[model samples]
Target: MLGSAGRLIRAVVDFALPALCALCGRRLAEDEVAVCMECLTRLAPACAPFCRLCARPGPRPCGWRGGLCSICADHGRQFERHRAYGLFEGDLARAIRLLKYSHRRSLAQPLGVLQARVVRADYILRQAEIVVPVPLHRTRRRDRGYNQSELLAQAVADLTGRSCTPRILRRRRATRTQTKLTQDERLANVRGAFWVGDPGEVSGRSVLLVDDVFTTGATLDACAAALLEAGARSVAAVTVAVAPAPPTGRGRT
Candidate 1:
């Protein structure tokens, strides 16, 4: 009886004030959730010509060696591999912004399910024994009231059938946003910022780190390094989107 009443109320409310796509602002169909199909189709997939180690889309830099991008070839990465669902542009970027800044927490479900599809198709990513979300600093999390990555991680774990272990990783300090920082500065800022709360939770396990975006990969690298130091067998990363490489003479995006 309660279920029927709830459905009726939702139906009336939806009819009166239909839900709209979080990205495009288009009215959602009865079957659709947070985003419209047209907006979703506009989200470009992170396919080919990308760095194998870090999954940075586009051509490798000049003098690239060892089949890795110049950055990876030079500094190397702590994670064994990384994958992203789409390029960070257009609808995809908007969708992430809605979830992260606008507090449209509902968007995390669809975005994470989409990311899981990418993970499902990759044999390497599918082998993740456990899923972990990058941790937010305690103060920041308290201010936000929720961790966006943790919400995404839960959805991904549900779809991928992996255990979501969010409490195992800890952010020791809050760092400034990487938005305008240089690549080197971004690395330095996040370095030693993460730690494992319980090494036994990640020890001997293949952890798949989840995040909203992959920029210069400094944050992911830092998290992966901490996981590895805690005796994790391997660490791989997945994100909803990957920001494009910065233009010449520009700081990291």
Candidate 2:
């Protein structure tokens, strides 16, 4: 009786005050969730002609050499491979901002479904034994009352049926925002900021790291470094979006 009444009430409320698309603010269809179909179609996937290791799009002719971008070739990456669903721009970027800043936690589900598809479709990524999110510092997590990366990791793990070990990694310190920082500064800020809780949990296991975005990759690299140091067999990453590469910046592992 209560279930039926709840459903009826929800239906009436939805009819009277229809939910709008998170990105474009269009009225959502009965079957639609947070975002409408048109905005979903506009969310572009990160297409190829990108670096195989880091998934960064580059110039057509000479952007790669031996399947690696110049930065990957020279510096090497801690994570064996990384993938992004889309470039951080347009509606995709807007959606991410809404989730991260405006506390639109529900958006994590669809974003993570996109990430799970990436993992399922890639042979190498599908081999991961465990999933770990880039951890937020204790203070930050307290302030936000949630960790966006953990939400994403849980969703991916649920869809992929992989073990989500969010507690395996820890951020030992809080760093300032990376938004306006240079690549070097970003790297320095996150270096030594992450650690593994139990080496045994990751020993000889492949780890898939989840995060919201990839900028210079400093944070991901820091997390990967801690995982590798703790005896994880390998590390790879997936993010919802990848920021455009800086003009003079190089990749980090």
Candidate 3:
């Protein structure tokens, strides 16, 4: 129903603004966001059959007798509980990699919105007074230009009406990447990497720790320890992706 001029303008706009899915590299439909429906279907959720404490996918989907993984069973985590959207694989993993390594800043909001929806549905995030991301060192943040976890935590705060208090939790020193590190090495790598800048910021408040992935729980556990030491009432965590059980062979988050 358009005239020649209108049709020409429409065509040019479409050409100039091509829509592509961030995960699968497919052209997006008219109303699609960063990810396409096909890619979404390909992505798997961290449903039951996962560890009750850490949310790691397990062989016994419905048979978590004690609802604990070996890590959670042998030694308790510093956080009260952990929740993850899905495993770090396929489109989800690709998307996270793009956000973290490839400098895909636009993908953060879309991913954050998805994660915020997950948090809004959970009562744990609702009860938390503030959201604090697993902080990065000054050098790392400078090199990265931005912290992806900070973006995610802010989006969650926007959706759930919780305040993002990142200043309270900070990295005291830089450490080697968790990549290529053994379980014990991962724990020691992040052992004293984090600290609370001001105890009053989170004193007497329950906090939610945000991270991109849950590998060994070392990083989030370290952050939780600092929060608790500073007088936080309680601490829980939510990550976009949760890794598989022990003997993991993935890169750093």
Per-residue CA lDDT of model 1 for 1-253, tens digit only, reads 1244554675576569868988778888987778888877777787777888888865654435756776788999999998999888877888888788766777898899888998998877888999999999987787666789999999999988989998899989999988888888889999999999999999999999999998789999999999999999999989999876786523433
**Best prediction by TM-score:** 1
Candidate 1 vs candidate 3: the TM-score winner is: 1
Off by over 4 Å in 2: 1-18, 29-31, 60-63, 248-253
lDDT of 3 by residue, 25-124 (tens): 7898976666787876677766777777777777865455587876787888999888888888877888999878766656666677667777777787
Q: What TM-score does each of the candidates earn?
A: 0.89, 0.87, 0.85
Worst 10 residues of 2 by lDDT: 1-10
Off-target runs (Cα >4 Å) in candidate 1 are 1-17, 60-63, 248-253
For each candidate in the order shown, give its overall lDDT on alpha carbons.
0.85, 0.85, 0.80
Q: Each model's RMSD to truth, in Å?
A: 5.5, 5.9, 7.6
Q: What is the alpha-carbon lDDT of model 1 when measured against the actual structure?
A: 0.85
Worst 10 residues of 1 by lDDT: 1-10
Q: Which has the higher lDDT value, candidate number 2 or candidate number 3?
A: 2
Candidate order by TM-score, highest to lowest?
A: 1, 2, 3
Of 2 and 3, the candidate ranking higher by TM-score: 2
